[model samples]
Target chain A: MTKENNKVTVSRRSVLKGAAATTGAALGAGALGGFPTIWAQNIKNVTLRQFGTGVSNLNDVATKVKEDLGFTLKMTALDSDSVAQRAATQPKSFDIADIEYWICKKVWGAGNLQAMDTSKIKNYDKIAGTFRSGKLTPESEIAQGTAPHTVGFVEGPGSKKFADNESGWMTLIPTIYNADTLGIRPDLIKRPITSWTELLNPEFKGKASILDIPSIGIMDAAMVVEAMGEITYGDKGNMTKEEIDKTIAIFIEAKKAGQFRAFWKTFDESINLMASGEVVIQSMWSPAITAVRSKGIPCVYQPLKEGYRSWGGGLGLSANLSGLELEAAYEYINWYLSGWVGGYLMRQGYYSAVPETSKKFMTEDEWGYWFEGKAAKGEIKTPTGKVLEKAGAVRDGGSFYERMGAVACWNSVMDENKHMVRKWNELIAA
Target chain B: MNNTISPEKTSWMLVSPLAFILGLFLVLPILIIIMVSFWDYNEYNFFPAFISENYDYLLTSKVTLDTYLKTFKFMILVWFFCTFIGFTVAYFLAFHVRTLPMQIALFLLCTIPFWTSNIIRMISWIPFLGRNGIANSTLISAGIIDQPLEWLLFSDFAVVLAFVHLFSLFMVVPVFNTMMRIDKSLIEAARDAGASGFQILTNVIIPLSKPGIMIGSIFVVTLVMGDFITVRFMSGGQSTSVGRVISNEIGLLQYPAAAASAVVLLITVLIMITIMMRFVDIRKEL
Candidate 1:
């Protein structure tokens, strides 16, 4: 019996030694932990590459949504245009991506995303009907989202830049969307500046800034051209190839005029340019408008008789990202569109896709001020008790939350993307 | 007779550990990277099958070649400038300096850039090259220029400046070491024989320092060839480089194309190093 025990002990000791040897080798190798390099071979987990700005804050939002459930969301930030291109070519790179409504139709046609799975989302039933089946919203639906829609104007010397009536599928969901209006420092370029012609006024020479971005920026220029009525693109969102050429010509003229003090790439750069007082008037975005207001500077979104144009962005799912992960992705999307999170996004200066969840969170006085455009009804506090003001409240698309979903634009590739980027470069150079 | 080991056997045994390490770390991964580059990236941007698409694009595309040309040009320019400046400074320290401590201090000064991280050193250049930077401010205040120059921070010249600042030390260390080894009697004898100072410096000092120059050139060229961050940060996306192109492809999750581009770069750098070795023995010099 003692001999048998000794033999058994030797076998056990050998097993322990083998285990330790393998573990030690792995530790010494500095083996990559849980690296999904192997996942490239495996088809189970889909990869997602999202391209945009504000990764720091978006990472926080992604964490909150992922932690609320057990889904793992692998997000990589990129340029908005680059995201559209990847979605255009490698549809499988991302199972889910956030794109602007302006680029929706073409991207969808490119087979980048699989559209609405209403079944996967249960609480989606709670969303307003206007957002479903596309457009046709009641006047009451205007203030339904988490944040009230604020009017944004086209490229002003000091104004915010918004996607106006220029064609292409609306790639953005239009959360923080603004209309094409003129923004001016009441201290510099005083009021009664109601039309597109004023943007070309020589008095503001070298004191204006415009977005250097080609696609949407051209659209804003087209709107101004349309407001002028002599130069025409013949369509709002739908333009022919010839129409695109004419629009480029009009933009080239402006570029040669040296009317702009600078062409900006980032939102912060625009702010810095404006703050330098070098640019007293320029096309701007909602956040910039809010920033100017917060500093107690007098800035106003000029109302135009011609309807202001706008653009938006929305969330979509991947075809391969089905089952629990897909369901989770949709849940996160629904929660985002469900008003609460949308309101939080809006309180920070954006429009919400869902208005109901955001509405309940808003006080009656707060609602009146933002929707009615009267005065500060009260110190509007968020769920976290943060104070925010309701400015840029007079949004033109009362049904903007619902009506903008018909948004879709096809992205051009190969020779076409080259042409677009080139045209933009020439426009800046000119 | 069998009790004593053969010299050949002893040598093999001694070299086996080094052979094993090189094979495992360098040879194996390189082979894998090359193999993977030839594969197709699937729905998840994962390598799955033997694919020609990645290579087809990288090899044939205009954008790829443009980036390669830009990268090569930048490498050559940076190498030439860095080597020239480094040799001058190193020559002064080695020949002109009177004290050994002073020489050591100057050598340490050459290495001061290494004391901090490469990234921090590069980024510190931004404040000095920005729109309202010190140079511009000084120029403006001194009435040398009217407005702030927007081209300073993000330009090809700026990229070169950063590259030289970062890498000049590689050239300095090798050249300085080479300069120190020259016999004083040889120089005196050359002078006594009526050889001019410039001639002696060129014929004796330069020819003798060929090995050191080769070693330093290889180091600087190889490093600058692989660098993308300095170009990317300095150029602000105005131009493209090989490393930047690879980084962009990686960002888009196009790993196969990125890997293929890396393979191409690896081959180019290898060819360069091989050419350098043909002229002089780098191993002996180092």
Candidate 2:
């Protein structure tokens, strides 16, 4: 296996060298009109390998890039955990690492990715203020936990440490994000559910679920615990060792009492649990709720009193990416934030970083329905043109501002992450 | 120069390819895991260092003991069901079936479900055993039970059910091979000596089938102990196994801890196999 990996690496290097020589010769023979045509021809040979979680590493986006930029965009979609593992461990395997903000906290220390220059990101000034200043509006209190802007910027291009405020250099160019909440099967429950505390209500015993991911799951647990009046954490995002212990203990007791039906780790599992009526209420992503509803089920991404636990994801260039490849990666990021890809992702219940740019690509009805909290003027459709909601249907949890503004916390990597993971394993074992 | 190679040299030559393959793939990987198990790790990276903390924590933690016990429970339960069902099926095929072609055809029929992916077969059980699934709906319609049985799915029962469904074939193939080789003359002699059919089965056939049973037991035991996905899926992430513990750690990028857990599991599995080997001389039987 090692021998084969080495051989592939060597052949790729030789290919890159050959491409560089050809580009150099083309430059040497350049004339004003012919140079632009030669450059376009050579760009067709460029292939940028990108990888991320299944949420946004899409084939449609790759196809669009191929059509518009005349370059190959090879995309690999892994689970969130695997995406982090690959980004931190295999620096040379990919050109772009599209990952979550919490994952950036983990991968940034490894220095596998180069800090992106904000000036080159055509729409950087137009990005959502939530990703730049950790607030929806200037008056909005920054949510607790690892908010995107905290780790989004660095001191300079060569810096590894995260800067306190926005610098010219960025760790990741913000792309897509969403405010997450509990999804409930209202037909089965037949009651008003409006709080995170509802997750642990014994009345819903054997019908409640949470994701099994340790870092994110712990934050969800903290929200439930705080709402239930069990413990008040200083920062739910960065829990102390004692805070972690108490939070896990509460969940373990609930588990023993059979309060949980199951803990899901993937998007489809959440949809399956809700669709099958196996789980009545659970912490769920926005898209999973949409998926359950699309299957003709009555599922709600319930707005809780305690607020949503939000996360953001973005594209980061690999440190190994340089020269033509680096320029192409920058071009891809600029295109991503420009309009079409943003609009495509926004249609799937996620908010694009540059909502203004996405608005241009979407119809007025689509914009009003998805982002302005208005009832659909007509039938709303997914990016694939499948009917999502009928006329008179409004998006769950209301408009983008209301949902993103009410975010109580962001998904975080705690200071005591190791202890939390160990305790989490114990919770599973128990 | 001598044109002919010596016997010992020829024997070494014959074994060299297999040795090289094992060394590169198996032995080297095991050695790396062992080395990594003793190293130190933080959140983002594992570094080379002589540290016992990973092992110390694993050996002393109550969770580790509980996970091991849970894994063992699964192993023993799955082993019992697989062995009993496997032996009965093999016995019927060997003694009751009259024609070789019929026996071969029946054996091939047993493998029909194996054509699809293992994950597909395991997941197919969800719709059958879920709250509103076929089993519960059927029970409700017949007035057999008013409420759905919650334990039918996402329980220890489901985990064991999937395991037995997936791995019984492993037991069937080996047991059937040995059952086919059992001497007919021995059964004839037992009958002539006034032994009943039950006595013939107990005295003549079972003793001869020990080797196959041992081999099958090994297969079932190791597979159950090493499995994480089946337990994770069938139990709906409500249950834990030794493999799951290691995998969870790996997911968190805690490699040294995961390696330590893996090393302990490997040792435990090895000890179990060694204990089983003592009950039967497998090489002589084969």
Q: Identify the leading candidate in terms of lDDT.
A: 2
lDDT of 2 by residue, B24-83 (tens): 999999999999999998767889999999999999999999999999999999999999
* Residue B212, candidate 1: alpha-carbon lDDT: 75
Clashing pairs in model 2, backbone N/Cα/C closer than 3 A: none
Ten contiguous residues minimizing lDDT sum, candidate 1 chain B = B39-48
Using DockQ as the measure, the top candidate is: 2
lDDT of candidate 1 vs native? 0.59
RMSD each, Å: 12.3, 3.2
Q: In candidate 1 chain A, where is summed lDDT lowest over 10 consecutive residues? A: A144-153
